[model samples]
Target chain A: MAILTGVSMQNRRPLTGWGRTNATVAEVIEVPNHEVAAAVKEAGPRGALVRGLGRSYGDAAQNAGGLVLRLLGSAHQAVLDPSLATVTVPAGVNLDELLRVLVPRGFFVPVTPGTRFVTIGGAIASDIHGKNHHVEGSFGNHVRALTLLLADGSTVVIGPQQQPELFWATIGGMGLTGVILDATVGLLPIETSRMSVDTTRIPDLDALFSAMSDGDDDFRYSVAWIDPQAKGRHLGRSVLGRGDHARLDQLGPKELLSPLAYGPKQLASVPPLVPPMGVINHATVAAFNEVWYRKAPLHREGELKGIAGFFHPLDMVSRWNRVYGSSGMVQYQFVVPFGEEEAMRTVIERLSVSGAASFLAVLKRFGAGNDSPLSFPAPGWTLALDVPGSARGLADLLHGLDRLVLDAGGRHYFAKDGRTTAAAIRQGYPRLEEWKAVRDSVDPEHVWQSDLSRRLGLTD
Target chain B: MDNALGEPQTILLLGGTSDIGLAIVREVLSPGARTVVLACRNVEKGELAAAGLRHGGLAVHVVHFNGSDTASHEQVIADVVAQHGDIDLAILAFAQLGDGAVTSKDVQAASEIAHVNFTGTVSATIAVANRMRGQGHGAIVMLSSVAGERVRAANPVYGGTKAGIDGFAQGLGDALAADGVHMMVVRPGFVHSAMTQGLKAAPFSTTPEQVAAVTAKGLRAGRRTVWAPGILRYVFSALRHVPGPVWRRLPLG
Candidate 1:
């Protein structure tokens, strides 16, 4: 816990999540770890919530009409213990900064989301998983212990061995349980910064599904880039990429010069000013999907790629969300059980028919989920897509998909959700009640709240 | 707590039974656990308007509101927020369309227009803005008449009222920009609603539904001002520079 400002102050700030929609205002306070307890105690009737890099793609980080605390955590203070294979990190520290320090030391985060801009707090709150979910599990699984500033203005350290119920509840609780101050996270010992990869172009959904199911577990990380526009025989056509951390011997002379060098590059950035209607549409997405698919090798093996190129290509463009236009953007990601292949295929078909125009649609397999009640993944296929908010009949289409997904025992990710009914959430997570009960026992006054909690009736 | 890609969770309609106001709400909202609060001087008319919008799952509440009584404004806004949490969107569609003959001679009509359309809205909207700013996220849509773009001579009193509120809404919108609350002014030209059903159809005359459609689009696009039928934006731009005498004499209808 750390927050030490001379005076207690608050700034009236309006903020929107990564998708840039549903802008909400709050009395934002920059709380040093020491002041976090005082800040939470002073939160008004609507209560308080903490925000990280504002990358949840929804209102998970917002607390309208209440207070929002930003913790003063930086990577400079992260203490890594190589002997114990653990790192004590402030919750506000993002992966980008942490990686800058760890990569040269031959280590990597146990789990990494699509974007490195996300903070350790958000990662646990959302319980984020990455390409290596099948091998490593979610962010919460690696979190050894964490400090939670409860609604009663009390700070407590919870972990798998201590107050396990509260620890699991807070993991994917969307910041409703309390504000996380810091965490002792386990790190993966890595050989080099580059990835030894495999790429294969599958002809259709059947081939893609089989390719992943047959051999994905053999690799440490795997994901597929989908072409939603390809219809009939080529429907769900994809380019599969699977890889493991490259060993020193696998690198060429040029790569050997600096095997552990890690500097994620920014090739270009989308400007702040973009058309209100956005530039992405059916035509643009179709062309992009075509070029992106063609650019990849038909069948490549052991291709050594940099960390940035493999894990976060989109990170190269700053404010890339602005390209979606002022109307805002909608990002939807969902996961169904492994046995529900038919349901997953139908969902993909519906999206294609709707012409979702998602240039970055991706599919990945998730391994067994942890005991966290609200965690999204549960040993299944997960698909993520970013669609323009202006998409025609989007609400109706998504609502329809919600029925289909829920009926097949699937659930939407709370982190990537901005528009889903409470009923849908209720149907998705059966353990929601158990998690809420644990949260209530700790803070019955319900001072910890967020817009997502209220929107989906998680805390209402 | 409202959905960005869908209809708002709650809406406050100032005009209560205003046709344009209800129409806009109808167009923007989809069926769900959504609430619409209607505020007007007459509770009966508000109930009647509420009946039309009472589809399955849509909750409509009628509250007493006197646009002329500026003192009661804050309470109206407070009551709605207290009962509904946060008013995601509000429509300032309540207006007294004074007699077109106010310029010739209609003292009572002029005062009514001034108090209700201009003064009442000024007070009520400011109250709403205050609460919304505290909430940190709300949208206010004021239904301004195209007549206000260049205060028309035919209906000077009504035109003058629209002009005042229109300017207020624009400035307030700019002020609220940093606060995250959005204020949009909708200028519809001669909309054929209950208020203007008997009146002669003017140039570029539209329907409440049409005005509502444009308003909904404006809110989505985050536009500060929107003209119904859209072409009126250019028409008013040219009319603003027209000579006073020549503008009055022109066969605008």
Candidate 2:
């Protein structure tokens, strides 16, 4: 392993992945071949950010002035069991690579979000959910066990049967409790690479809710791509898509040959000039939404679409975020309980009325969240928004939404947040006292901290 | 410099001639401290050093501080605080790293290194520690060494002095914990400065510039002890636990 000193500072210009909040730190440590144990020790007790494919779209993988373990280049030794449909993978393995290797062997990840560029470790840290979360739960649910390196510089294996407290604490711990070295996760059986999808464009918010509540169980994966510009009676209007993996009998011979690979070129894109406009004004957003809803393939059920086109359509565009211009963008995701859907509606309405141009709005049904104290998930309806960087008062606007989140008995996902106040955080995560006690007991010197820790009073 | 609340801080360096001492002062005295008193035995040399520091953009003053004059430590610390409000940092950099073999044969040389290095730092650290505890915020940087890990036959006197300072600084660090006072004990190996001139080059050779950078990082990280050529930190861990029989056979200073 090459030990590059901070004295031999690299002159590379500062580059931010997706989260464009904090200023870049000059003294960056890039341990090319450092062992997991050595890197953990070098972080002292302060902990480190284990960076993978850098697909977080936020600060989940950024650590300023602190060490960032680029685990992407770390060792890769995966063991797959075809019969049991489980795979033990190194934390740094990307989802795209994982599925490519396993899907041919008749298995697939139980749940995956809109992107296949994320690492298995990142998926667990964020506890990401897909269209089928209402039935299969979040990614943490599929995890059988995790090999964790605790804050005390000791290694421990955690699972439901052993070290249950630590296991639950780490399920959605967001890399705070420790660094996940590897995971043994269960995979679901898949018949073919294509999805038997059913697409519907709900005309208004009422029909959208009624359609989902009435027919959600008929499909394995369900998602609603909302148009945030819709206003008045048209508020919450969306193009809802749901699907189940196509069985071998359902697929034609041509689909079977190249099972999972995306079809010819169903391109995903947006106007390049739209991102720089910043505010995503109400007038402009309304026009965009009207066109999108009208463009949805009407009444298209049992449509044969490849896996990538069905589940991860956005993966087609390279550096798709450039559409948001130089300032980048923020992925604002929050959850409200079924009873609090009204509160969720109000927030959506407010965002639209305020001209928060959010082109990509994803709505998912989340089941029970993991027991991790700081984990941000609940049995609720979650709405995620992608707002362009040009929006003014972005921080203030998010703060306003944070209050609504706190009021709706919901907590802001630390992995997605960059500007939440400490006071609001305290209100959002009530079990923080318990986490603090554990953190203090293991680290009496108060050594482990991060940008999020300093911002949200996660540490003393 | 500035305290946590933005108030201007004050500082005094007892052995201003020491390179490591000046490095610590240079690292911690920016943005907050309104005054700095460089206390040395020779006023003329101290004035010259202070003038150079002033020319380089620092508020500095020269004063007399003879480490052998033990009774004067309390008064020196008090005078600096009186002239410049509260003393936020008081550095005990007065020490000598002379040849242990030569000092062993020369009683006068051995006594000077012991009294000036070990005793002076102990007195000054205690004096400033008390004042800072009462006022509720101050940091003390004591210059120790890797030689302090074990007393060696090659440089027994110098090693012993470092050992004593290391022990004192550790205790002071623990004692000042709840009182809002902090202590940073620095240990560097084979530093390339006037202190190590004419001596054979050793492994992990370092410069004052490197020492300054690490010390600044340590202060910001709220570290208690900073080791220059950071690898020595792991080296000392093994040396500190070695038995006397095994230690005596090792040719280490």
Candidate 3:
């Protein structure tokens, strides 16, 4: 008599989600397009979990016996208001789709991550940054408004001008603030997809920092490829690169066909599920590191690289995470203020001595701090690494790194972190208590929640 | 957590052979939920879906459950609880449907429908609810429908049965409110399932996938009710407000 609408008595199998972290739920809900608000209300707050593209490096998207709101296909794109240089987009709209339409219109996002595949909501929640954080700041800085569905099923519009407290609290509060349904974001003008390029191989950490300090003002985007294998004086050897939009004059007569059309054929290979204990060993990574470091030109030079090639090299392989196998992997990124740059050195030293191998090691100098309380960037030195999540002793190693990062007055990026302890998270996120106070006032019943919320003890 | 590093999820499907039910199980249970307990009468068909879900990485087992076998219902519940420690989630999704003409011709058909629909639910709920209530918490989703709101001659038998279940779940929800025991009654309009194979798309007809998605959300939110094509909540609200005389004259079934 109880009408079970879609219960497949024949196929009455309970389905789940993509993020492989937790699997405690008995059932899953795939709401119709644009129904996150009503669905949240109907789901009625047993500590719900909101999921984006399932691309988070860790358990931020996982939950146990809790409600998971998968927003990607549930919400679609909204109309753009060109006059205001702004667009009203659903929280589910991925960045790639947004940029494809915006890039040709002479405007672009001020900050974007390595892959434009992330959702706008995920971007703000994570407050992701690109190589240009040295100039533009994190994605939250470009957001103008956020429409949130609170725990009690009430909706509120928060932004810098409206509900400023909730705005700051939710900016990087993860999904703990509420389900982000839509938002208005300011866009930057861009002439083309091409980046007028430059490259320089700095021999040592000192030279690397000095180059960034002196030349960062000259480029719109900047980052350094660090060699973690290098020891002693050459510990942080790197290749520095800086660029801006390519001007029409910079193109040769033959290249003038579409001077700014800079998307190149992205060609990269991702292995099928990594063989148990597969290729990312110290010997393999050491060899790869040697070749990469040697390939950097010894002298400074300017070279033209397509935007996608330069910014999103990882996007080439569609499901590259499989390369790390079923255990998955973590992208460890942390920022220590300039005064505590030594912390970066200590981390590198620890990784080197432990023989922990990482494929991608990047170093960047962050610029001014944004007003969003939990924003990750500051006037500091940031280092990011892609280390295997299942690496033996990874938990203890990461715990040690957290201690050093805290002692250095720094914090880990929640967006990319999966294993941080609640105490360590509190120490890393200085503004968390302030954000929690705001969340407590709005979601007094404490309904809005996610896997990250439970992991960090941000909710009951 | 239902899964370890690479293990699949453990699922308990109450009514094992429902086609739309299985499709939802396939769509959402993919690559996770390793152990699946299919409680059904035909152990063979149950084994088939179990194998299918297993091929997708889930380990499935078949147990016996007859909705009309009220006396055995308690034992079935006890056996499942004994075997699985505490059921992570028990999908209470069993029901009976009959062609309107046959149901009108033979009141026996209506009685059979009620046997599986209302009486069966009450009997099974008594055992399952006790177990869940005693366990301190778990989610129990009963499949309900929009037709349950008002019975019409077109399918009065099926509709009346659903009406009883819908009301029972509401009351059961209130009773279990404090025990951390939850129930989600899904009210989907006409669905394009095997049960309605040749039926044309009604104004609100939806797919099994859509129903599963909404149900998943309802389960996650710990909601008491889930409506597929969610606008049905307001639409039904308006229907309730229509005067009895006008409602009776309406041609729509």
Docking level of model 3: incorrect
How do the residues A101-185 of candidate 3 rate in per-residue lDDT, one tens digit apiece?
A: 7666666777877887788888888788899898888888888998987876778888898989988888877778888888889
**DockQ versus reference, model 3:** 0.04
Better of 1 and 2 by TM-score: 1
The per-prediction i-RMS, to one decimal, reads 1.9, 14.1, 10.2
Query: Given the true complex, what DockQ would model 2 score?
Result: 0.02
lDDT of 2 by residue, A289-315 (tens): 788889997678888887788887778
Quote the B-chain TM-score, candidate 3.
0.89
Candidate 1 vs candidate 2: the lDDT winner is: 1
TM-score list, all predictions: 0.93, 0.62, 0.63
How well does model 2 score by local distance difference test?
0.71
Using DockQ as the measure, which candidate wins?
Answer: 1
Over B1-253, each residue of candidate 2 has an lDDT whose tens digit, in order, gives: 2222112245688887777777766666543245778999978877777776663334799889888778998998888777765466677877777776789889999999899888887888888887775444457777788888766778889888999889989997997765556688888887888788888766777887788778766664457999998999998798889888997887542
**Candidate that scores best on TM-score:** 1
By the DockQ metric, which is better: model 2 or model 3? 3
